[model samples]
Target: MNGNESAPRDAAPRVVVGVDGSPSSGAALRWAVQQAGLIGGAVDAVSAWEPPVAYGWNAPVVDTSLDEENARRLFTDELREVLGEECPVQVHPRLVLGNPAAVLLDAAVGAELLVVGSRGRGGFARALLGSVSQQCALHATCPVVIVRAE
Candidate 1:
């Protein structure tokens, strides 16, 4: 370690947070951003969506673009609600069409951490952890942090 020598540059820890436009997710997003600032890392805000399909003996065809567009809007709104126009640390917004848990798990690969809320828009109202959060906690490659809604 001399004046002319330089230390190796290490990548900062990256955190992946699930955002579903829910109050709990809003809190999670805020928490993730704060954690990222503390760790000198970045935040990946992921939002997942599924096409709408009417349930019946025979379902009618629905326009998937509408669903995707809405997903994108919701993702943007959620990020804005928490991070405002500018985020303190780097924030990567990811909008994917698939199962929420699966999408989150995939995005968390090689990431330093995965963060999710204890509850979201769906699932039983009394469950300690929502399905997506539970799945991510159990299956995410990196350590999972469940942030409860305030």
Candidate 2:
């Protein structure tokens, strides 16, 4: 090691982005990838899905294991297809069974940035931001970037 050649001070940071198969999320993914290139960081694509619930007059039941697995597969496939093989940075796919906001917030705990879509499949049409995006922006430990839908 030569004293004249100092170690590179700029280290790659970890970036986490949440996806839900929506066009808005696709934009977020693209944005994250670009940011990763600028910072020489890796991107982790995360998705959260819960099982459908059956509501009855007598009882309500929910089983999410299968749904979670399906979600994982979907997210993985999408990442591979959308990101393609030419991307320079590393990409990781993650899927969990829970509320989207909660899962994203948890993953953001140690990340340098958390990226999300501006809107999702929510009922409210006039809201500026989707519930998940708003929640993450408010509660995430890292910086939150919301990519608006085209």
Candidate 3:
């Protein structure tokens, strides 16, 4: 290769995957890794969280700093569990605080693809009920892929 020529991977596509530390999300993460490898691309592991209600039913507001840290831990653990310590393609872990659908759509702005789990509800039927994957499929600028756990 000539020095003037750039590497193919330098312009590789970016695949964004939503990970919520669930079994379905683990499957989605695996799928993202494989897809990224196939296209010589990278994966953006995006995890979103809110104030939590702050959890249970109408519970009191908890410390947000701790919540953020816990979210990061979950994100890291999920990645490690799914892709292990070493992954074939580059995997960027992103933790954001917002609606899952909004977070994913924002991340997918310039991405080559956006991936999310079926959340046990498959197809357009889930859209009627308003799932994150459906919101992504309908609004993402790039292609959206909904993966289901094995």
Q: Which candidate is the best by lDDT?
A: 1
The candidate scoring highest on TM-score is 1
Model 3 lowest lDDT segment of ten: 1-10
- Pick by TM-score: 2 or 3, better one: 2
Off by over 4 Å in 2: 1-12, 56-58
Ranking of models by lDDT: 1, 2, 3
RMSD of each: 7.4, 7.4, 7.0
Q: Write the per-residue lDDT of candidate 2 for residues 97-128, one digit (tens) a residue.
A: 78899988887766789999999766488888
What is the TM-score (0 to 1) of candidate 3? 0.80
TM-score of each: 0.87, 0.84, 0.80
lDDT tens digits, residue span 1-150, model 3 = 221222254567889999997667889999999999999898888888876555556667667798899889878887888888789999878888888888888888777889898782333543533388778889999998888778
- RMSD in angstroms, candidate 3? 7.0
Q: Over all chains combined, what TM-score does candidate 1 have?
A: 0.87
What lDDT score belongs to each candidate, Candidate 1 first?
Answer: 0.85, 0.81, 0.80
Number of the candidate with higher lDDT, 2 or 3: 2
